[model samples]
Target: MSKSEDIVINWARRLQSLAQAGLTYSKEKFELERYQEIRDIAADMMAYKSDLPLAKVKDLFCNETGYQTPKIDTRAAVFQADKILLVQESDGRWALPGGWCEAELTVMENCIKEAKEEAGIDVTVEKVIALQDLQKHSSKIFPYGVLKVFFLCHKTGGHFQANSETIATDYFSLDNLPPLSVNKTCVEQIKLCFEAQADKNWQTRFE
Candidate 1:
């Protein structure tokens, strides 16, 4: 992320925290409105600095009331032969084809949907590969807390179809994987996923 993006994110988080604190501690409606106005200012700052539009910034920040929650991201580790499926994103980096979990779908279903949407392949989730808590790791990419759930999947059907989110899809050996999108998929997490695939006794490792 750029320096401007960092500033925008930090401002938004601070504003959100302020709003939550005000709502929880103060009973007056006027005070709540004041804090909400501050959040709106923070949203404006984000709109000025980030790629997101003003409406999107407002929806992401000011519209929320109390406590802010981290999003749940779902991914699948689909192995074919001895290689694993990876996607080349629009930014020209390879990453596991996955995204934020949708509200209406179960986690397993979301992982399947992401595989199709991002990699153009249908897959069945066999078992959870790993449940990683991003907050525990001191990483610059996921500074804002996130929970990543990786599932060990088997290819069911469908041809590889790359979409707008992904430019190409290919398989890679564990040691020869391309530069990955660290914010979305990290090397340690991928190793854990592959390890789970190799171990039958390791049911699921949640961290």
Candidate 2:
């Protein structure tokens, strides 16, 4: 996106966050109405800029009622020798086996669950590889902020089976990576995981 578009999106996100907080904590009826208006305005701004309709944008961006916080996503980086496991998404591109963290599960548990669900692999957590701010690394724009957690996992068992989210699974080296699902997994993030895997003393990277 262009600089102007980025500015608008950033402002919309901030406005929606403020409005959400207001709606959650404010007791005055007039103040609640004002917050609701602010949220509608945020949705309008996004709708004007994007192809989505006003109602769609509102549902996607303004329906949450809480103090706004970044959504958490978990990624499992399972390696076999020099190759890393990657699942072919239904979109016909590859990504690390992972998804949105469940509210009831710990991050590590989410990692294990995602691996089993997406790639049909059983894995045990080895160490955290990185914690990434999605906005910093991804080009795709989200209605809310996102925090992506990467875990270096050791495969215990299970083999790939066709699933709803993924069509196939395979291992690839850095020298030969397939077209990646950039929104979910990027080259730099994969490189960080490889670096963590090679060094036993690797510290968990953040930001």
Candidate 1: 10-residue stretch with minimal lDDT: 136-145
Runs of candidate 1 exceeding 4 Å displacement: 1-18, 21-27, 37-63, 141-144
Q: Which candidate gets the maximum TM-score versus the true structure?
A: 2
TM-score of structure candidate 1: 0.76
**C-alpha positional error of residue 27 in candidate 2 after TM-score superposition, expressed in Å:** 1.6
Candidate 1, residue 44: Cα displacement in angstroms equals 11
lDDT of 2 by residue, 44-138 (tens): 88888777788888788987888999999999999999999999987899999999999999999999999999999899999999999998997
Which candidate's lDDT is highest?
2
Q: Would you estimate the TM-scores of all the predictions?
A: 0.76, 0.96
lDDT for each of the candidates?
0.78, 0.93
lDDT of candidate 1 over 1-207, digit per residue (tens): 666666666766677667766766778889978976876676777677666788876665555454767778999898877788889998889888899999899999999999999988889888887787764543453323478898999998888765779999999888998998887887887788778878888778786
